[model samples]
Target: MKKSFKLFLFTLLFAYQFSAGQNQKKIDHQTLTWIRYYNVLPLTEKWALHSEFDNRSFVNPIHENLFVIRIQGRYRTSKIIELGGGFAYFNVNTQNPDADPDYSIPEYRTQQDITFINDIAKITFHNRFQLEERFIQKADKNGLLDEFSFAYRFRYRLQSTFTLWEKEQNSLKGTISDEILFNYGKDNKRNTFDQNRIYAALRYHFTPNLGLELGYLKNFQRRASGVDFYDRDIIRFTVYHRINRKF
Candidate 1:
């Protein structure tokens, strides 16, 4: 176990070290802000529907970038494991709002994910593996937009949540998470290293089914130029809720 852990740490360090040393002169920096909403509707003890939305904007000047919505059907197999399938739709635009010939894109994706939860010592940990099939739109030579390109990506996330205080349905918690993504498929011509996200948040559980979270996230992304990268800093606000009835 110790050897495997050391190997994982070594790989992570090497990857980041390599990325940090690449295209130092071409790195782009951006600030972003987002508000996210999450919901869960439990139909039974083992089945649930989940949905989420995100409104994203670039900060430091305040302009819109994208909006996204996703829906999922989730099945809980046990206390420690769950599986889900979802679809997401995205309306995305480039940074400029008034640019002539607006470059707005509509995107679609289907996703599957497996979630695992466990506790080590006193800290609670959650791990997720997600795979996505993406269909992206592009403007054809005739100047008509068409969706004809496909892409695939795999993502993994590890998160730990620690309780600060708890009393009945009210509590405070802190969480930290790291996620990495790799992309493939026919349409993906850029770097294989897609993105990495690091996040930290504080959450307040006001009721058994509702919570609010405020967080900070840093995103590192490989650009289409293949060598250049961007560092995006995001300020996040999220509302999460669950709806369930006695069954």
Candidate 2:
């Protein structure tokens, strides 16, 4: 497992370097902020629902960037393995960061995923793999909704958490995660490497069922042009809630 993890990291780094060296066009750099809320509700010992809402915006000058809503039904097969399927909706602002907001694009996504969890001493590791089918609304020259473009994407994330402090039921934790994504299909010709995100956060739990997190995330993305890119620096604030029912 350790060797495979190292290989995966090395491959991602190599691909990123190769792609960066090939891009001759200017890269768009932007600063952004994100506010998010996530929830987990347990229906039974083995079944659960996960839901999330995220709002993203540009900083400094300040304008809307994107808004997302996602939900998933998850089933645990064992202590370490969980399977999930989900749907997501995205409202994307395709305009430049400095430009005024134009017509937003609508996107629908269906996703399937599996996660593997492990623990080593006080630290926990989560390896998640997901596949997404995306239908993105297109616009004509008049900016009217035209047709829908279809694509597929694959995503993988490795996340870890460490207990920083603990007193009774309340605790403080540190989290670090990295995710890489790839795009494919007839519509995704130019950009095969979609994006990579690196995140680090500090989380505080008032109880076992609720927590708040503040994080910094860096997202590097390749555009459909294949030559252009976006380097985004984002500050994220998140609320996490979990509900469990006793039967």
Top lDDT: which candidate number?
2
In model 2, state the lDDT of residue 71: 98
Instruction: Identify the runs in model 1 with alpha carbons over 4 angstroms from their true place.
Output: 1-15, 23-25, 95-103, 140-144
Each prediction's Cα lDDT score?
0.82, 0.87
Q: Tell me model 1's lDDT, rounded to 2 decimals.
A: 0.82
lDDT of 1 by residue, 1-247 (tens): 3432443365467458867678554777889888999999998989999999999998766678899999999999998899999999998776433332455678899999998877766677777889999887876434436456788999888778888999998999899877888899766677678888879999999997899999999888887558788788889999999985888
Single out the weakest 10-residue window by summed lDDT for candidate 2. 3-12
The C-alpha TM-scores of every prediction are: 0.90, 0.93
lDDT of predicted model 2 = 0.87
TM-score of 2: 0.93
Tell me, by TM-score, which candidate is best: 2
Clashes of 1: 0
